[model samples]
Target: MKTAEEKKTRNTKHQKAVLELLKNATKALTADEIREKLADNINKTTVYRMLDRFVEAGKIHFVTGQNGKSFYALCKSCKEEPPKHIHNHLHFQCEICGKVECLPETLKVPQLDNYTIRETQLLLIGTCKRCMNSTN
Candidate 1:
């Protein structure tokens, strides 16, 4: 495990670029999409490492798409000190545009009688407002 100081030192320019891309994105992006948006100098392996680092730092989070592809996005309320990963909202995927985004509302997980809910991931599929508006 790397120390906090080491993690801080590992934040290179390429990592900053990757974070910038996700920060400006309106929706979550896949690994391939992130690599494609980055400079040619950064390779696939390096991109994955950077992503893992960011995830460990609680700077980003990912949700699995319908196709089982992981889409990464910036964490809205994650902490970097102890690294807290808390996502209480659901994910929305626009079927028409093929874009995946995190919804703004908070999700309420149901209470079960005996079942324990460790993790929850919900993906709602339908046409987004942009696609709906474009039709009329």
Candidate 2:
């Protein structure tokens, strides 16, 4: 357990980063992006540790990438966005570009009725439009 000051500091830092990245991000980004943006000020270990808290706090979501590392993004704000979150939007992972995007208007993830739903994540692997068009 951390002290109150520590917890507060952690919350402020993580929340700021989460919102900053989410608002600017087109899709999900890996820890590498975070480190790149913040540099030495944001240690990789700190990012991972803070990510855990953000996930638990329902501020962020995670998905597995082709590289096997867990990619993360800002959680769909249950308030402004549709409740169909968790796994609502289908993911589009670019093969050549190696970018993961949340296809909001695309994949319609089924919402299971019954029982409590805790977390949801989806992965759609394919070549992105940019990559596909480039191939042709």
Candidate 3:
């Protein structure tokens, strides 16, 4: 019988591979895209499970596109101590190519009376420069 720590560490290869994929990706990648880039023969379900674990661990963040597709990207502000992460930035989704990218700008959360905000996600949808240039 393996200890919980051993169990978590044992199945870390897949998680490490997925984290490397996200770290190298310039834009957010979907699970299918990640699977296509992985060297190992990993299944879609496994990829999704790994992604879910990463999200819980604050190693990555995800955005749902306007087309209903979810893309994952690394969370640079993730801290291992408290297992917390900050994702207070805007996400841009290209309408034409369906690609999602993180905006460099940060969002300001407004203060409300007697209201508490847990999490916020700002998604801006439009044609990306690549798509715009190609059309022009």
Q: Could you tell me which residue pairs clash in candidate 2?
A: none
Better of 1 and 2 by TM-score: 1
Per-residue lDDT of model 2, residues 35-59, tens digit only = 7776236667877877887777666
Lowest summed lDDT across 10 adjacent residues in model 2 is found at 77-86
lDDT of each: 0.81, 0.71, 0.81
Error of 2 at 72 (Å): 1.3
lDDT of 3 by residue, 8-84 (tens): 77468778878888988899999999999988787889889888878777778888888787889998754442232
TM-score of each: 0.76, 0.73, 0.81
Q: After superposition, which runs of candidate 3 have C-alpha atoms over 4 Å from their true positions? A: 1-10, 77-84, 111-116
73, model 3: CA deviation in Å?
0.4
Error of 2 at 126 (Å): 0.7
Q: What TM-score does candidate 2 reach?
A: 0.73
TM-score comparison, 1 vs 3, better candidate: 3
Comparing 1 and 2 by lDDT, which wins?
1
Error of 1 at 10 (Å): 9.2
Following a full C-alpha superposition, what root-mean-square deviation does model 1 have from the true structure?
Answer: 4.8
